[model samples]
Target chain A: MKHTLSVLVENKPGVLARVAGLFRRRGFNIHSLAVAPTENPNLSRMTIVVDLEGKPLEQVEKQLHKLVNVLKIQDFLPHEAVERELALIKVHSTKETRAEIIQICDIFRAKIVDVSQDSLAIEVTGTEDKIDAIVSLLKPYRIIDLARTGKVAVSRGRK
Target chain B: MKLTGAEAVVKSLELLGVTDIFGIPGGATLPLTDALSRTEKIKYYLMRHEQCAAHAADAYARATGKVGVCTATSGPGATNLVTGIANAYMDSIPIVAITGQVATSVIGTDAFQEADITGITLPIVKHSYLITDANEIPYLFAEAFHIASTGRPGPVVIDLPRDVQNQVINFKFPEKVNLPGYKPTIRGHTRQIKLALEELMKSEKPVMFIGGGVVLSNAHQEVKKLAENFRIPVAWTLMGKGAFPDNHELNMGMIGMHGTRTTNTAIMNCDLLFAVGVRFDDRATGNLKRFAPHAKIVHIDIDPAEIGKNVKVDVPIVGDAAIVLRELNTMIENNNLKKTNHLAWVEQVFEWKKKWPLKTPDSTDLTPQFLISKISKAANDKDLIITTGVGQHQMWSAQFIELNGPRRFITSGGLGTMGFGLPAAIGAQVGKPNALVIDIDGDGSFQMVLQDLGTIARYNLPVKVVIINNRYLGMVRQWQELFFGKRYYAVDLEKGSPDFVKLSEAYGIKASVVSSVSELDEKIDEMINHRGPYVLDARVKEEENVFPMVPAGASLDEIIGGD
Candidate 1:
């Protein structure tokens, strides 16, 4: 099972390396990791999505807790949280297929961020499934470049 | 202040409060070395090998629980540090490894003496960085120290390219690091704590399996208090050696293979095994199925995966040991689950202890046991810290020395690494300068990084190194004796060992040689009272073995002792 872990750590030097080092040393396969400043000025939040199941996730969580700079670790399951991902895809476009591409974007609720007659830059935001669906739809339009912000999530309950 | 990489590294030292460092200078690190030559605030001890440098830094960190520092150049220099870095990661010691990389442009091109150090070190260090820009050096170095010294402390590396070392830049040490992806939870969930307590209260024959994490958390008092409150006999892993005083009534001593007979017995028969701050390493738990087979394990660790990695945990508290322990203590106090007596189990453990006493050989020559005891007696309980390399010496140190305080006995517990002593002794000495620091090392283990003698002498650090010169890799020989039917292949150490007195003199220190048991105390005292680095090269019987050793693949009952 894939695990998405939200870690809040002190915005201090070398912490990223430490966390990454720990995962690598323990042989935890990380699918994607994104770190950004949190609401707290002194803290940073990292969302690490790892391809680990059962006990390894527990061990990683426990180990992360040991870092002094690390303030919190929240392991989010698929159903317990609201997950979101953002992706930008630049597609080869022409007068002939431009309308068709725009129609596909409308169907997926994706926004066209940029258009240069020959190319269309589309931005999509949703759960992983939604993003994957949009990417699949854009494949026929000949996508030129693709970039994703990995996965970021928060719990569903009022906090 | 505008500074180059060398100056940033030097200034970063002051910022990190590092008064001394152990390293060697090469073409890649020359710029930093030149800057160090002019600095008076921090001292540098030139080492012979990068491995020795890393080990010394690691040792220093372990001894004092501070971030030990080491520096090396690019390529093989950085790779040589891999072993020591891995050792620190395994042992959970705080250390910072700084290496010089080739200039940024040539990094991927494989310029002379270049290596992908950060990439290579990625898995070993708690964190690592490749400072492509000189401006980032100060902040990165500061962050490295902060990360290395805090949390579940471990090694961190910063690879400074030579170009960065020469580039003068607008320098500003960031007040704080802005990494967003690394948060660690310090506190445990209240519900989980309550559940853990419930399990503890309901269970019979509960055993507390402690690891080095307790010491790292500085929760020895709390651990001892909790153990006493629950009347739980504590069985430590190698990493957990000094967490509880070995002489304490509840201490069954180090458990697992090579652990005490009583401890293994307790582990086997226990109903509830409460493991705190311990990773279930294979050495600690042989044949996972057979390990604590009957125990309903409550594993409290900061790492979540460890909870069910090897040994399954019924109640897993995924948080800091200190935080969880404090919570557990509070609940125990509030609920009043203190047992009046575990007299029967205590008596049973005592009976086992008496039945299988750690016996010594009848050889007239001095033994590692007597030597360890002599060293332990020579130093005060609170002031002196002991560090050891792996092998027979490490096991003997655990078995013989009564560690009354936490973080006082530093050893490569999880890694079982050789060449851990001298540098660790330096680290311990650096942690507490006023205290007497000693490395109770074996000759074979000591030779792994004997170059640390240079580091010790150069810094003028007061560390007494007592080498148990047995002229053989005693542990390997013992294994050969036990499992390989005494067909010793390559365990001999008769070739490389030089005269201790001569080696010490080369390092500008005095060394003494003792052959008999009668001269043990006098030699120990002489080393203890020496003003600076000293060596006691005590040549014991060549084949002296660490007894009461549980043969591999066998139960604790199959202990091998007696000649």
Candidate 2:
């Protein structure tokens, strides 16, 4: 099973390396990780998706909490949280195929961020499934390049 | 008061009650060294190597239960401290390591003697700091000591750049730490304690499995009270050697890969295992599937990550060992729970212990076990602090030595570093100046860090070094003899080895060599009574191996040489 953890840490140099080093040394499998500044200037929040097949969830949480910089951690269940991913996909385009690519983007609620003579760059932001679906739809147009900001999640509530 | 960062560092250390620091001076740390030399509050001991300084600091912390301090210059010097820092991390010893870094402008340029020490030590330390400004020194030093000495104590590193050290700033020590993320859970939850007590009352064959946390928390008395109050047997891990009296009737000695036959048997037969302050490492739990198969485990530790880490627990309590045990003892007393007589179980364990006593070979040549036994007998009357290098001699010392108080037996249990004994002995001796410190070392392991003999001789510390001179790396050779069909690949240490006695003499210390069993006791007594540092090289039987062996992957019950 995959576990999505939202971790709050002090905004300091090398904090990311410490967290990443711990996961590496302890042999924890990290599926995806995204870090960004939080509302507080002195703190940052990290969204990490980890594969917890053989390892215990409590142990991982405890280990993360052991790092002095880590302030808080929240393990989100799929139903109780709102999750999202963003991807920018560049597709090869011809004058004949450009109209079709724009139509697919329109259907998926995506936007054409950049356009060149031979290629069109499309940006999509949604749940992982929606991003995957739109990427698959554009695969027929010859995907020249693709980039993804891995999943970021938050619990859906006022607890 | 306005002061340079170097002066602030010295001031912070003095304010934190640090009386001594072990380190070596070099190019990068010259500024700090100059400031330290001018300060009269902290005495500095110059070490031959950064690693030895770190090990010495580690042992000093282990002996004193205070955060030990060590320092080094950048790059190579900082890199050399890795092993000792990792050793402290593995054993959970509290230490503060300060390393000098290059100037901020030249940090990324690969300047002379510059290294990203914080990045290199990220995985090993509890926390690390790379100072960006001189003002952060006071706060960082306070935080470093706080983090290093609290909640599952471990090493913390502070990397100070040369320019930062030279910069001046207003110096005022923080009245309190502002870390909101690092509060430790010191008291056990009442509901968990009640549930644990209910399980304990219901258990017929119960064993209290203790580890290093008991020693770390100074909860030896609490552990003894809980065990004796319930008529339960106590089994300890190697790190928990001195947590309970070895001569106590209920003490089951050590439990794990090299654990006693009776201790392993008792654990395997128990109905409930109450483990405190133990991580249940692989060496402690041989073949985890078969370990304590019949027991419902109740584990209590300060670190929540250790709860279900290696083995699953039925009842898990997260709290400091001393506090939790005290709470449990209070509940036990308040409930007026009648002590259940476990005569049958106690008798069964005693029978096993008597039947499978640890044996010594009946030979004219001095065996490691026999020599250790003689040392134990000779040192029986004094307050002894025993340290060891990792290998056959270490196990022999653990098995034969009688430890009655906490922090008496110090060794690298988790890391099992080869060259730990000599420097650790020095540190322990320095920490407890009144006690008799002895390093029971192996020939191979001793040769790894014998350069510290100079440190001992210079300090005139009365630390006795007993080298069990077996011609081969005896532990690895034993494994080869048993599992690898005696191929004996690179296990020999006979050739190109310095004469330890001569080496000690050259270092201006008293030295002796004992090869016969008849002279073992007399020589050990002489070494113990020596006024200053002394080395005794006792050449034991070359092929002797530690026995009642548990093959690497075998279950504890499948032990080989009991009879």
Candidate 3:
């Protein structure tokens, strides 16, 4: 099973390395990670998606808590949080296929951010599954290049 | 109130109640050393190497229960403290290591004596700081000390640039540290404690698996009470030696590989594992899947990561060992749960203990085990503090040296660093000036840091240094003989090892050699009675193996050389 943990750590130097080093040392498998400064300037929020493969997620969170810079960890269950990933896919587009690419982006509520003589850059922001659907739809057009901002999430609550 | 960063550091240390420090002076550390010298309250022990200094500081912290401090110059000096720092980190000792960096202007410009000490030590330290401004010194030192000494304690590094040390600032020490990310849980959850207590009450064959946390939390009394009042057998990890009375009736001795067969057997058959202050380290667990196979583990540790990281835990109480154990003991006492007795189980454990004890032949053929037994018996002080270097001698000491209280037996349990004993004894002696500190060392282990004997002689620490000279890397030799079919690769220490007696004498310390069992007692007395530091080289039979050996990764039940 996969676990998505929201870890808030002090915005000090080497904190990311400290957290990452712990994971590496403890043999925890991480699927994807995203980090950015939070609303509080002194703290950074890291969204870590790890597949523990039956290794208790509690153990990983507990280990992360041991890092001095790590302040708090809130694990988000799939239903309780809104998750998104931003991906820019450059697809091989011709004069005939440009309209089809634009149509696919419109249907998915994604925008075409860039266009080239031989390729079209499509920027998509949605849940991982939605992005994966869009990317697969454009697979026949041949993806020339792709950039993905793995995952970022927030809890869906008033608090 | 304005003072240089160096002066501020010294003042802060004085206020922190740091009475002694161990280190060598270098260019980056010159100002700090000068400031330290001006302080009459703190005595500094000049060490031969920065590694020795760190080891000394670590052992001092273990003995004194205060945060130990060590200093070194940047680059090589800072690097030298890595093994010692790792050792302390592994064992959860509280130590503050201060390293002098190049001036901030030349920090990354490849300046001489410059190293990224903070970056290098990041993975090993609890927290680290690189002084950017002189103003950060007082608060940073306070925070460093706080982080070092509090909750699951470990080493913290403070990298101070020389310019910061030279900068003048108004220095007023802060009374409190405000680290939003650094709060440690002191008390275990109430419901978890109740569940643990229930498990204790319901168990018919409970075994108390103790670890370094007991010594770290000073919870030996609580452990002893729980074991005695409840009639439960106890088995301790390497770090847990001296955390309980070694000769007690319920004592199953050390656990895991090379543990007594009795302890291994008890763990094999136990129904409930009341593990307190233990990390479930692989060395103690043997094969984790089969460890306490029939038991429901109730682990109590301040670090929650330690509880379920290695094995499946039934209940985990994350809090200080002393706090949690005291609560459990009080709760059990108040609830009248002491009436639950496992007499048959206790008798079964005792039967195993008697039948599967570590064997020592009664021959006079100069064995390490005999020497350790004779020394422990001959020592007069009830408060004897013994430290040992890594290898066969360490295991022999762990087996033969019977200590009555916590903080009495200090060894390199976690990292198993070989050169730890001498400097550790030095640290222990300095920390408890009146106590008899002895370093049970091996030839291979002693030769690693014998230069630090000069530190002992200079301070007249009166540490008894007993070198068990087996003329081989005995543990490795044993391994080669057993696992590798006696190929005898590089296990010989004969050609390169020093004449330990002459080596000690050259340091202006008393020295002697005892090669036979007849001279063991007299030589031990002479070494102990000496006013200053003394070294005894006990030439023992080579190629002896530690037992009862459970081969690495094997189940606890598959032990060899028992009885």
Best by lDDT: 2
DockQ class, candidate 2: high
The lowest-lDDT stretch of 10 consecutive residues in candidate 3 chain B is B333-342
Tens-place lDDT digits, model 1, residues B1-563: 87877888898788878877888778899899998998888878777788878887887776666678999888988899899899988888888988988888887897898888877876677777888878878877877777777667789988888888999988777788754445455788888888888877777678899998887777788898898877788899888887898878888878767788888888888888899999888777766767887888888876554568776778888788888899889888887666744557767877777787665555678987788877877785548788888898888888887777777788887677888888778767776889888889999889878877887787788889999888899999988887889998888988877998898998899898988999888888888988988999988888767766666666554556521
Q: Write the per-residue lDDT of candidate 3 for residues B1-563, one digit (tens) a residue.
A: 98999999999999999999999889998999999989999998999989999999999999989999999988899999999999999999999999999999997898987888887787788888888899989999999999999999999999988889999999989989998877888899989999998888889989999999999999999999888888889999999998989878889999988899988888999899999999888889899889998999999998877877788889889899999989988898887775456788998887887787776756769988888988988883556999999999999998889887889888999899999999999999989999989999989988899889889888888899899999999999998899998999887888977777778888888899999988888898888888788898889988677888899999999998867
Q: Which candidate should be chosen as best, given TM-score against the real structure?
A: 2
Local lDDT at B506 for model 2? 97
Angstrom error of the Cα, residue B546, model 1: value is 2.4
Q: Which stretches of candidate 1 lie over 4 Å from their true place?
A: A1-159, B37-39, B334-337, B380-382, B553-558, B561-563
Q: Give the top-scoring candidate (DockQ).
A: 2
- Position B471, candidate 1: lDDT: 88
lDDT-superior candidate, 1 or 3: 3
Give a tens-digit lDDT track for model 2, residues B1-563. 99999999999999999998999988889999999999888889888888999999999999999899999999999999999999999999999999999999999999999888999888889888999799989988999999998889999999999999999999989998978889989999989999999999888888999999999999999999998888888999999998999888888878877888988888889999999999998888889999999999999999988988889899999999999999999999988887665667877877887888877777888888899988888998899999999998988888899888899999999999999999899889989999999999988888899888889888888999999999888899999998899999999999999888889999999999999988877898899988899999988889987877788878989888756
Range of the 10 consecutive residues with the lowest summed lDDT in candidate 2 chain B: B338-347
Q: Which of the predicted structures, 1 or 3, would earn the higher TM-score when compared with the native? A: 3
DockQ of each: 0.20, 0.84, 0.66
Residue lDDT tens for model 3, A48-119: 999888877776788788888898899999999999999999999999999998999999999888888899
Off by over 4 Å in 2: none
